[model samples]
Target: MTNIAPPLVLTVAGSDSGGGAGIQADLKTMLAHGVHGMSVIAAVTAQNSRGVQGYWELPPEAVRAQLDSVLSDIGVHAVKTGMLASTALVETVAEVLAGAGAPVVVDPVGVSKHGDALLEPSAVDAVRTALLPVATVATPNLWEVEQLTGVKVVDEAGMREAAEAVKALGPRWALIKGGHLPGEPADLLFDGTREYRFTAPRHDNRHTHGTGCTLASAIASNLALGADVPDAVARAKEYVTGAIAAGFPLGTGIGPVDHGWRQRAALDQSRS
Candidate 1:
């Protein structure tokens, strides 16, 4: 049999010391989806189960160098960005992504799981004006949507308005996450014309530390493997729902969803 290489997916995000979110979560999600994952470490966060203690962003020149090295040589099938702390870094990443041949997923991460500010308030404008227009899909949770567009979504019906607000920012598609809503979790995907709504049984677990990152990365992975935007979002929702169900506790605080929940289930079944 011939060796088949996996689709190459690149994530330009921060590093989570706890191995739950950021670069760690992205790589794990890619591996689970059988994609070759690459990274351009945009920032480094000293975080754990409780919360983010602190973070330091890499220099813009250094970030540019890494991006150039990756794109000039081993090109990517898809790109995803998260936790670009400052305005300068976001501007730099947007510049590079604007010229990228692959589909781009932008997760406008405003705050961390522990409620710490990740992106600077001043940088929100940059994300909306510069970064979003280049995105194939922009995945913003309720809080992030409110942060970016000043639209607060309390119910499923409100997600559409939020989606419109985001699409107006110029992405080819927009996915407004309604996981923060009460009742069942619903996500709305719109491509300026049609709308796709995905709802999953809300997992009861509270240790959903990296759900946003996982969902966005999964979408990128699926896109790398040739799924359309709607199909990609649908598949990603299923994966994240399972991962959320398999979430286990860590430390004294919230934990991350099991990125390899499917593999773990398969292993358990085989042993049984």
Candidate 2:
């Protein structure tokens, strides 16, 4: 028999004890997309569906060692970063990923779904300077757009402006998510030239805990499988939209999107 290789997608992010976001969500998304997932934990958070109570950033050396061990061994085809809690951690991770030779998805995670701050104010400059330039695509929610590029997004026009502003920071492309915007949930994608709008009817659900991390990971997984930028984003949008729609009630507060919604559906179908 011929040897089989799994496409590896690496997540350099924090740990959400609740398993709704961060590394938990990233790994789940990779598995759902049929890719192997690896992780380099940057921070650990005492968090749950209710909110983040506390967090601790890991030492830069430890973070570096983890990245080195992975890249030197199992290797990675794509990378997605979330919750770089400090400037030091951001810089360290950037250095590790600088020559990764794989598509990088930077999700500028500023706050949690429950409004808890994850990225530090001091780290914003480091992320913009070190990571953004190396990213294949930078994914930022509207709040993160403002936090990273100082571009306040009030409407659709502002969203386009935010995407352009972020693209100017040297990333090949930028995705400005407008889920926080009122009315229809839409996300804008631009590469300093063409634009694509991804929209979905609002799910009217309060359980969207890990949507950002999930989307980025799905994009990374598709990219690892050789999909180009536009096709990767389009497929990722479809996967995440279905995840949000199939999200179930969990915990006492907010819950996670159903990363394995398709698996659950298949099981139901088999039972019929």
Candidate 3:
């Protein structure tokens, strides 16, 4: 058999002990895209379906060491970032990611599904100044948009305004997730010169714990496979839409979007 290696993608994020989000979700999403996934754990969270109990970030030097170990050897085709809990961690991760040749997908993860703060308020400015500038694409949900850009996204028009605000912060592209909006879930992507909007039927499932992390990682995987920014977002939109539909309850609280839902379906059909 020919030894063929898959496209490699890296997720620089926190670890979710619950296995629903963070580094776990990112790696699962990457595998669903048929790419190799690597991780640099910036923090560790004691979380479950109900909520995040507590978290601790690794030292800046430790973070830098892990990043260097990965990028210098196993080298990634694309990168994705999530949950740098504090300002110093954010700055450290930003400095490390600033020079990587791969495209970077920055997910401004603010809180967990159960409303626990993941990134500190003080880190918001660091994300805007040090991190967003290095992003090939920045993914921010409505609440995060408000947090980072101070833009109140009240309606579709507000979504556009938020995208512009995020673009102004220096990312090459902005993906303003309007999933919190009423009716259907939609996301708007803008790159100054052009824009793309993606909408999916709102699934009634409440198990959407890792949707943001999964979507951002999927985009990184697609980018690693050589898709352009807009196309990568579109493909990720489709994947996450299906994952949302397939979401199932895990623990007492909101569960997770099924990363292997497609494969699970196929297996079920075969057995049937």
- Superposing all C-alpha atoms, what RMSD in Å does each candidate have to the true structure? 0.9, 0.9, 0.9
Q: What are the Cα lDDT values of the candidates? A: 0.95, 0.93, 0.93
Q: Where is the poorest 10-residue window by lDDT in model 3?
A: 178-187
What is the model-wide C-alpha lDDT for candidate 3?
0.93
The positional error of residue 20 in candidate 2, measured at the CA in angstroms, is 0.4
- The RMSD (Cα, Å) of candidate 2 is 0.9
Clashes of each: 0, 0, 0
Please identify model 3 stretches exceeding 4 Å from their true place. Answer: none
- Per-prediction TM-score to the true structure, in the order listed: 0.98, 0.98, 0.98
Tens digits of per-residue lDDT for model 3 on 16-70?
9999999999999999999999999999999999999999999999999999999
> Which portions of model 1 show Cα errors greater than 4 Å?
none
Worst ten in a row by lDDT for model 2: 245-254
